[model samples]
Target chain A: MRNILLTISYLGTRYHGFQVQKNAVTVAQTLQDAMEILLGRREDIKGCSRTDAGVHAGFYCLNFKTENPMPLPRIQRGLNGLLPWDISVRGCREVPEDFHARYDVLGKRYRYLIWNSPARSPFWEGRAYSYYPPLDLEKARAVCRAYVGSHDFSAFCSVKSDVEDRVRTVTHCGIEREGDLVTFTVEGDGFLYHMVRIMVGTMFWVNEGRLSVEEIPAIIASRDRGRAGKTAPACGLYLDRVFYDLEGLRWEEGKDLG
Target chain B: MADLENIEHLRKKRARIGFLKKALALLLIVAAIALAVAFRHEISRLNLVEQLTSHLVGIGSGPGWPVDISGITVREMAPMGNDLAVLTDTDLIFYSAQGREIRRVQHGCANPVMKVGGTRVLLYDTGSREIRVESKTRTVGSKTMEYAVDTGDISANNCVVLVTQGARYASEVTVLDKNLAQLYQWRSADSRVMVAALSDQQDEMAVGTVNVRDGQLYSTLLLFRFDEEQEYVREELAGELIHSLRYKQGCLQALSSRRLLTFSETGKRMAEYSLGEETLTAFDSGAELFTTLLVGDYREFKELDLAIVDYTGAAVGGSQLDFQVEDSTAAGDRVVLQSGGTLYLYGGGALLDEMAPLMEILDIQLVGKNLYLLTPSTLEKITVR
Candidate 1:
């Protein structure tokens, strides 16, 4: 059997998200069905991660095993052609039988957009939240900086999230603005559900003069979701990319010599 | 000769066995590496889910280095540019193409207000009656000679149009140059001007007046000469209760509560159509497109539609955009909309695309592009390409 990795992108607006559900349409179910049709067999496919409903992915990864020996390019093309317009496969590569897409991911990055305007936008009607009130970018930045380093981010996550470990490392966080648009970009080893949104919500308090940037340490120490800003809407957030170690995939002299 | 042949055969057999062993070893190594990779990915995924759940449950610090700002609000977001301009409601803050702070203008305004015009930054202070024009190389500031009027608003043409209604009770539309100098002021025969809009060229102004006896608002799109006398030469359109009006290119677009109307600059009615049952929530006009957003019922939040109108007052394309409120508590969160080549969506107080439960979209803005969205945030700096 051959294992293959697939890189994909999809619009998350309609489906239940990236994972498959028993009765709901999902990106995974759709891709699995398409693959089943192309391969003429029921193949169990796995996704890199499960994105919640309304969550979008720019670069997502998945893998499936098959006994067929078709070329990698054909698999990528055939699956893309059969999938819906909103879902697209960018590339595919054959891997050793043991390789897995979700299990091999090293880290992920996400971005959040804020439209701070006084008038509601007709174009961005369903895409962004209209924050009419003013914000303090400096305070937001300071709070963002506090999110860096390895810590238990229990304070910034949503309730009802069932995970074993709360500890994660945030590699980077920053706030930026142009004209009337502000954005927050964060990268980390991993994230909690609604972590980015709640962090943003807490930062809003600082930006809006309600919370102090210095208080972030206390908030982190508390590990309370109620202390953070409202969980931001789902539309404005995007999974930007995922990273993996590139040791054996590409030519390495040490491995080659060994 | 027989002994030599036997030795050669033995050597060949040994060589073949060695090659096979090497191949098997290589295969094992590859398998191990693949397994390791797969294991790492699985562990990370589990760790991520656990970390996410724990964080959501308020146990650990979330992802990234925590950044603390006074406050952060997405002021304006452009999907095509993947860039957002945010303001802290204080001074001028400019972000680079890579989401970095490039420049900031301190003490730029006591109360900074911005009107977007084809990538131009027309900033004004109602309190000080001051105007500042910002571009790439030059930052110019000017003050109006007259006192700041109560009902003054800037037009797409960068003209400040005002209607003063106290004491004198006279209707006036003053055309100001970029320097805030009174180029000309056109006074109406009657004193009750209801609404006004400036032509895209800044050469003309349209005014609406209410006829009390008929209990209806009568609007006339007037042509004015800014250079010479500033006199109204002709009346463009007379309509009842002009609810909204916008001037783009050479055409004057107006909307009553019940119908959509278009007029030419030469005082001629171009076209008129009924708006039907959908209540117009917002309207915007660009050089190439006129957009209108309509909402049905709040409880049902029933039908949300975006109608794109051409210059000739014809509906070229229309589509229904859906938004879910989830429940009653999700109400009151402002939905932000923006348009350039395509429409962008945001709700729940954060910019869209950050937590997109849908597809990944890049938000971008070109230098000198005019982006219009509704928020209460102050306007930051405008980047000139």
Candidate 2:
């Protein structure tokens, strides 16, 4: 038996979400159906993290062990042909057995896009957050920097999360703008549900001069969801990359990839 | 030319001042009306929040509860949200959760015992053989048994009834169906039946029996069919006194003086929960996600600490109120502990609210979702949102 790990991408605008839900058309459900059709049986697969509806993903990894004698390129072509255009199988590779997609994760990267131009763009609709007012770029940059390092991010997470521990470490967070598009890159050890969207909303609040730079640390210290900024729209979020420590994780055959 | 320009400037300034004064007067009138309307709405909204929140925290008014207690000896009171039932010495009064007395039944009682489940009520008269199942504004069923009941409980559907009677060593039990039809009867000549729990489905019963053998008290739990003595399971023990037996959801719980035990309907022991101290009195159970209230002394000071035990038999949290609590009942997702003159509200095993300075709380009953306080004079219905 060989464990096949696949990296996939999807335009989440038309899909419900990444998880398999009851009576809902989700990215996971569609991919699972395509796999069942290609393999003529069910394959046990799980995504690294769940994405909310209308949130796109540029990179995601899933692994499932199968005893099929088919080759990697053939399995990938078959599965992709069965899947919808919105979801595409980017690449598939043979990984060692016992490789999990979620638990062995080292870190993750997410990007949020914003259109600061006054004119409404039909193309960027469902792709970027549009704000006509002028934003103080330096103030936004300061709060983004404040989010770096280890801290409790309870205020940035959605209250629906029942997790007891909300402490996370952000290694990198930066904001840059070229023309009308302002891109935000955040790399963290872990992210809670809607953490990035709330952080983005808070950045704009700083730019709009509603919240101050000094209050960011106190908000993180409060550990209360009500003290945080509003959750930005799901359309502007994109899962960029997932980092894994292949050498540290247990796998058969003693082979590793970093 | 300079004098003409000055006259023109003064004329324009005067016109602007006149407009500004009129505009300011109109704005003041509009603001006053808006504030009056908002003030009225805020008062009612606060009233509604107090009536519905069920948090039982800092309440400013008794908008959806009883504000007065006219002098009357309330025999038994059952409060469940909007359906409130109060049994006086001579009449059974039904009231809404909002303190509105709806109906009064022409039923009298000598020593009455009432059990409120969901919205159904079971009232038994110890002096007589009368057992009546009632709800708000209506009598579901009534029966006159051959033996007077020491205590009784009807099923949630008002279909099955388990009534037990005992004096010294001889105790008897009767199981009845919805039409007051006798399904099972048992007489114990060598033991005293302390408590009996009838399943809500009316298919089985669990009885706690105590008998003195060799001058030692021995307790036995017997599970059997409602009508037949063909026992499904039976177990015996020698320890604390059995306080009560209750059938809630799908499990039959035996509440003892020291430990709490849950058993399946088929008589297999599921779990045993020991509170580490002797239970003071009968602990309340029978909620879906039940929070059992244990009032026992955890310190040498003899002060009672109210412990909230979740359904898993684990004490999640508790209040250190040290009040001499009489009884505590689970209402919705909250626990209402009633002592002499105070009511302690606990949610998620933590004390969320408390009401004190109350006039002698005799008993507290939760029906549906409302809490009914049976004081010396009135049956007060309170909702802890």
Candidate 3:
């Protein structure tokens, strides 16, 4: 037996999430179905994260063990032939049997896109969040700096989560703007439920002048869920990059800003 | 003196017994050799002798012969450009003339079926509404019908004909142009379309349909022009179910369960050949001038009689085969029959070539001089001798 790792990407508009649900279709179920056709047997899969419904992913990792010795190129071609048009297997490789896709993750980066234009784009519909208001770019950039470093983020966590330990380390938090599009990115060791969405929502509040950059640190100290802004829509968020080792990632401030 | 005479008589009796045993052993050895020679066709089907011979001669064991098709179940195949188009249960793959896979695309269908005409190939789902028209290189167009598709075909001029279940009638025929524009449509209130084909000139069409009349099933052949709403000729065939219909050399030829009927361009019945007691096992009318039929004594595992007839319903040439045929097809003037792992190619009523491939042949198609053989695990392209 050998452990096979596959990196995939999907639109996520038609899927419930990355996990198998009893009543709804999901990315994990779709991948498993395609794999079953290729390998001629069903193998259990492990995904890197439980992405929320309607949340897209640019890069997601999954692993499964199999006895079939199909070459990697043939496996990739066979899977592409079986998978749907919306989901695709980007790459595949054999990994160590002990390497777990979920447990071995060191950190993750999430990106939120905002189409800050008055008119909605037909091409980006169901793909990006459309906000018509004029956002104060300077205020949004300043608010991003306060979210870096370790802190108890109970204010940014979803109220539905019951994890008592709320302390997390945010390695990089940055905001950039390119014309009518604004991008907010955050990298962290781990996150609570709806943590990235809440952070993007808080940045939106600061951009709107409803909250100040100075109050973000106080909001973290307050440890109150009510102190943060609303969780942003799921369409704008993407699980962009997954890291098993943090030493390889290079970060720079205002690198992508227009 | 009496005891010595009795001993001599006993020795002579023992010698006679040994002589009889030697003769009996010689006769058994001769019978076994005769049986092996007589039943060689049955033994060849197990591929024991052919495999051993091919291994010793290093024939058909070379690379680049049998293209791998292990993962997909092939449903239909046809010649595309100089290559071949194979429609599986899920995908459409194009292989080169040398049996090398060139490209593959998902047809996104469950029960995928295919028809190839000129450079265009039409793929449709049997119980679904989706249909796609693709050329040798790329997809030309696609359409979704209002009702599920029953069957369809493509013309040499790239026109598409689709027969689908009707909303208000028993069946409907929709014709589309080369660019997938709606050209014409017809609906039948009582009959269901079984097979349809367009003329080579693209000016006329022939449709075969079946309907129950007074509790007796009847087959009808309808011929129509592209601009006319009503059929110019309708021939009713009682107690028959049409299996195939095609237009060849300005005449419409149709095959039913029991008869082969041909009609002239003026709606006149030219000739008809009926199978009185024998059963029609397999038939193909894809050839330019002749159609091949495999008929037997209405029983399984019986050797079939090959019948090659022209478009005028006249017998050209045929012969009885020693092996039961799985599939038979005709192209140009040659007829190819697949029985087990061997292929018999006959031209002008004479056997041209016989090849016993190393793999099992499931289906075969002879386009031009290239013979495409579908195996259980691969597709092989061989040249006719």
Query: Of 1 and 2, which scores higher on DockQ?
Result: 1
- The better candidate by lDDT, 2 or 3, is 3
Task: Give the winner by DockQ.
Answer: 1
**Candidate 2 chain B minimal-lDDT segment of 10 residues:** B53-62
TM-score-based ranking:
3, 2, 1
Candidate 2 wrongly placed segments (more than 4 Å)? A1-258, B1-69, B117-119, B162-169, B277-282, B298-300, B310-316, B319-321, B338-342, B357-363, B366-369, B373-385
TM-score of chain A of each: 0.89, 0.93, 0.93
Residues B338-376, candidate 3, lDDT per residue (tens digit)? Answer: 777778998865688898888777888787678888878
Model 2 vs truth, CA RMSD: 23.2
* Clashes within 3 Å, all models in order: 124, 7, 0
Tens-digit lDDT string for candidate 1 (B1-385): 9999999999999999999999999999999889868798654423333333322332223332111332444333322122233333554543433334433454355565554432224556645545565422235455553444434445543456665543454665666655556766866656466666676566776666555445534554455556656444444333345655667667777776556777777747788766644455544442334534343332222235555566678765554543322211011122324332233432322334322212221232222233222222222222211
Interface RMSD values for all candidates:
10.4, 20.0, 34.2
- lDDT per residue, candidate 1, A75-164, as tens digits? 888988899998999878877677777787777777777788898777755455567787678777889899888989987776768886
TM-score of 3: 0.48
Over the stretch B195-230, how does candidate 2's per-residue lDDT look in tens digits? 887776667888888887878778988888865676
Fnat values, one per model, are 0.00, 0.00, 0.00
Best by lDDT: 3
